[model samples]
Target: MVLGAACATLATVAALRSGPAPHEDGSGDGGATGGPTAPQAGQALAVARQEFGLLSGGGWAQAWDLWTPTAQRAVPQAEFVRVNTECRPPVGVPYVIDASSVPDPTTVRVDWHRADTTGSATLSYRAGRWRFAPDARTLADYRPGADRLIQNRTAAGSCH
Candidate 1:
């Protein structure tokens, strides 16, 4: 009974946290849908927060787990670990939740700042939830010097 109550309470909290989008009315940069679903926005924020938290704390494996299925499929576990470990080593902590922008009802962009630099990510609404689905450009060209032409590169562990 106690466990069930706790679960119910948590669910309620989650629902409450997922309030309506800034532009809940049928018009705004938020998109074609009437508005971004509350659950989607909350889920995206929760996932982003958790991932950033783990990454900032240097828990590479745990942070990798926070990634969406798509991200996991795109980058292998080893590669994800390597990337986060290398790029976010000094990311300090994911202490700050920078402002969020709903470019379209289907997309929300969240930016994070470390000690001296910043990183931004976008989440898209899919199946009634906010998910990480960056554009082809972002996925293929994360690094500044990465190849711009990433059409059909065949590699055993290629993210593109």
Candidate 2:
């Protein structure tokens, strides 16, 4: 399973890299000058990709480390691992980051799709780094023993 996940991560990375060449500042503009938010958007997208890679590779602790402080406070590390491990998302499924928008100077919204699942996540720039900031719904759904989100994902064929 770990091997499969690693392969998937590699494939995902390859797909992303092959899609477009980013500017020196990390903006996916092929050296074209983007707006003020372009660099920050790129940073948030990188952080989001790293978090998802960690999750897909079963690096739960590392993935949790990328969560915002508020998200960490809402869901304990053990509970997060337990829930994810119990039902685990499918391995080797490539995810596509569709779009990213900067809602504010400090916040970015990323839209992504994996298999049949489409979702969004918010990332906040804090203390000079970007972190996943789970919304209220996500935090609630990730609560200990909560299975609704898992069930939905499983039904959608995104998780097993």
Candidate 1, 82: how far from true, in Å? Answer: 3.4
Off by over 4 Å in 1: 1-40, 83-88, 134-160
- TM-score, cand. 2 vs. native: 0.70
What is the model-wide C-alpha lDDT for candidate 1? 0.54
Best by TM-score: 2
Best by lDDT: 2
Looking at model 2, report the run of 10 residues with the lowest lDDT sum. 28-37
TM-score of each: 0.52, 0.70
lDDT of 2 by residue, 12-62 (tens): 544543533545554324533443333356667777877777775677877
Question: Alpha-carbon error at 6 in model 2, in Å?
Answer: 7.6
